[model samples]
Each structure stands twice: as C-alpha cells, then as structure tokens.
Target: MDVLADINEYLNPTTARWYANRGIPYRRGYLFYGPPGTGKTSLTFALAGVFGLDIHVVSLLEPTLTEEELGMLFTNLPARCIVLLEDIDTAGLIRVEAPEETTESDDKRDFNVGDLTKAFKKAKKLDEALIRPGRVDHQVPFSHASQTQIKELFERMYTDDLPTTKIVIAPDSQSDVLTPPMTPISVEFEKNGHGGEESELEDIARRFSKKVPENMFSPAEIQGFLLKRKTEPRKALEEVGEWVRGMEQVFKTA
Candidate 1:
C-alpha cells in the first residue's frame, strides 16, 4: 500500500504515453481544492511518483508569495514536473481579492473573481521559458470530493480496506452483529438523508460524473465522525449534520 507505488500503477502506460505524446510546451491543469487532510497534497506526490517527475509543492497560503516569486516559480519547472499550488483560492500573489471595497466595520472584502480568472489565463498562456508547457499543471477549483470517492482513493493509496471492514463484536469465538469493531456507512446518505435511488447506480453515476457535488462531507471528516462514534451510526450522522450547520453559521457570520 505504498502511496507512491499505487500511484505508479494508477498512472498506467496510457498516461505516460499521453505525457510523452503531447506537444512540447503542453500543460495539464488539475484543481485539487478541498478541506484539509483529504489527501490533496498526497495525490500530487503520488502523481509525481507515477509520472517519474519532480513535485514542486507550493502553498498559496504562505505569506511570502510576491508577483516576481510567483513568476519565477512558474518559470522554473523541470521538463517533467508536477507543480502543486495548494489552497489556490487563497493565492495571495494573484491580488484577486480587493480589501479597499470593504469598510473596516463591514468585515467582508470583495473577491476579485476577474483577477483570479486573469491570473489563470496568464498561467495558461505563458511559454516554456515561464513554465515548460507540458510540465506545469494546476489542480484547482477544489471542492470536497464525495465521501465514497475519497474512501476509495485512500484505500487505493493505503492498500487498507478499512472502508469494507465489518462491524462486529468478537468473543467466545462468535461475533454479534449488533456490536462490532467497526461499521460502514455512506456519508452521502447520512448527509443527504436519502435512500437508495430507484434509478440505477450507473445512471446516478453518470449524472454525478457530469456534475460532481460541492461542499459535501469529505471522506476524512466522515471517517473522523465514524471513528469517534464507533458503534453509533445514527449519532455519528447527527454529529456530522450539526458540524455542517455550525460551519454554515460561521460562514454566514463571516
């Protein structure tokens, strides 16, 4: 379950072929935005392992990113590299949010969506000298991926099937179904409070593929609740719901 090894397999020959065949100065962008600890950074390292490339990990959350530094970072990608910009929504050098629009009392600054778009556009148009076309890529617009997907990815990377473990109590060489070491529950249903759809999993899958969920509980958070509430699925679900409500309140207040 080496994350790097698993990523190598996931990369596959086709991916290498894609990397090899793309024209010089070609670039691919990935946006891996999500709540922390959902493996966003891990995925980048894994990809670097798979592609036999170097990983340039940058945190936009850092206070020191100036325009010149950003330009230099982009300009120095090795021929085959993965340049990771974490928390891109907070990229300070982009100047995407204007503070002048908000009064001190208002406590809400204007997000310069146009500036962000322009920064992205600039990144895309830059030549190899700025960033080798095929080498520099971005992972952005990150929303929390579905709980199921995150679990799968973790399982894939970790090679541990914790997600599929059965919940049972073991004693006297016999286990009781009502009590157990672990339980599996779908966060999708817990959060949405919906039952299985009459539509096929395929149909649901296709629809979701076309439009992924935003602001859903990530696998890590879901696992945290589950682990904390071990044998109480209902209580765990309630806690998750409450957490979401609290976050909503905080956001509203902000």
Candidate 2:
C-alpha cells in the first residue's frame, strides 16, 4: 500500500479531485492532532510520496521564530510543497516567564489574552494566505486515524495494491500546479536501537520541553495499532475507542 493510495482512498475525494484538477492557488490545510503515540506527521510525508511533493516542515516551538518570522515563512513557501506546523494547540498558547518572575507557576503558564491575541492574529494571517485557493490545495488531517483512517494511512504506506493512473504531460497547466516529490532521506535512530522516525522526533520535541523516551510511544504505534486490529479498520477503531473511553472515565471520576 502506498501512502498516496491510502490517502486517495481514505482522504476526502474532494481533496483528490482538487489536486487532480489543479483548481486553486490556496494550499490545503491539514490539522494533525492527537496524543503522543499517534502518527500525525508521518502521514504528511507519506502524502509527499503520493503527490511527489516536497515537504517543508516548521515548528511553532522554535525558540527564535517571531510571529512575523512565521508569517514570512508561510508567505514565501515554494509554489507546491507540504508546509507542516505541528502543535497548533501549544505554539504560542503556553509560555514560561523569565526567572525573575515572583509568583509560583508564573514560570509556566498558558499564554494570557494579550499573547494569545497576538499569536492568533499571526496564525489567522498565515492561514489566510496558506489556505487560499490554487496556490496549494488539498488538506489531509492526521490524527489517531480511528480504526478506519489508521487502516487507510497504513494501507497507503504498506499496501501493495491500489488504483493509480500516472498522467505524463509536457509541462502543461496542471504540471506547474503539482509539487515535486521530496528527496530521499533516512533518519538514523539512536545507537540504542530504540528509535523512531523524523516525524516522531519532531512531535516529541515540539510537544514537550524534553524529549519523549522511546518506549512510551512512537509514530509506529499507529501502525502497530492497525496491525493488532488485524488490519480490520473497524476493529482498529477499537484502539481509538478504548483511549477515548478511558479519557471519558478519567474525566468522569475527576
């Protein structure tokens, strides 16, 4: 199963149609949100495989990226490429005050109204440009692909059989619209042999102040979850269901 095929099958057909037609200049906005173990970022790259587009990944967590810096980056992206900005929930939403702060927890607090407003303005401006029609269109939201989406994602990645048609045009209207494929790259996991890929690494680094130890979760967990469900997407949904149920229980108790 190729990631693109799974994407074609599981992703909203409207997106595929948009991609195939090259209808807009705006990029498709994908929101991949989930707990630590889920493979949100991996799917971005997998789609890269299918569309033959390069991926330009950015972290909202970068220490030096000002709101303007972010806006400029989004504005200047290559005509066709995947621009990933993970941890939307926390980017400018949380901040640690300077050491001179007097009160407890001031050192670590969810951003206040002023900061959030600024960040929101920046994000809104960025999204406005990025999600516009034609520049870059086709959004694929990656989460813990409920048994179904997970199956779809994996099938896209590992499945051997899928329906595909390669249309070769000599630089026509749509040819300029399509993004080029990402170059071959490999990640070297740690010497311990307990490692994860670049997406996992990006997620862990972005989400928390510290690195996520390998055993707790990895991008592969999504695949493992799918396999454990015997590749039955509905059955695989049980994994997502269990987690949701557990959260429900904890909230109920609290």
Give the top-scoring candidate (TM-score): 1
The local lDDT score (0 to 100) that residue 162 gets in candidate 1 is 46
Query: Residue-wise lDDT of candidate 2 within 98-152, one digit each (tens)?
Result: 3433464232212221232222233233344544555434543333223334334
How much is 249 displaced in model 1, in angstroms?
3.2
TM-score of each: 0.40, 0.36
In terms of TM-score, how similar is model 2 to the real structure?
0.36
Against the true structure, whose lDDT is highest? 1
Q: Which stretches in model 2 have alpha-carbon errors above 4 Å?
A: 1-25, 93-254
Each prediction's whole-model lDDT (CA): 0.48, 0.46
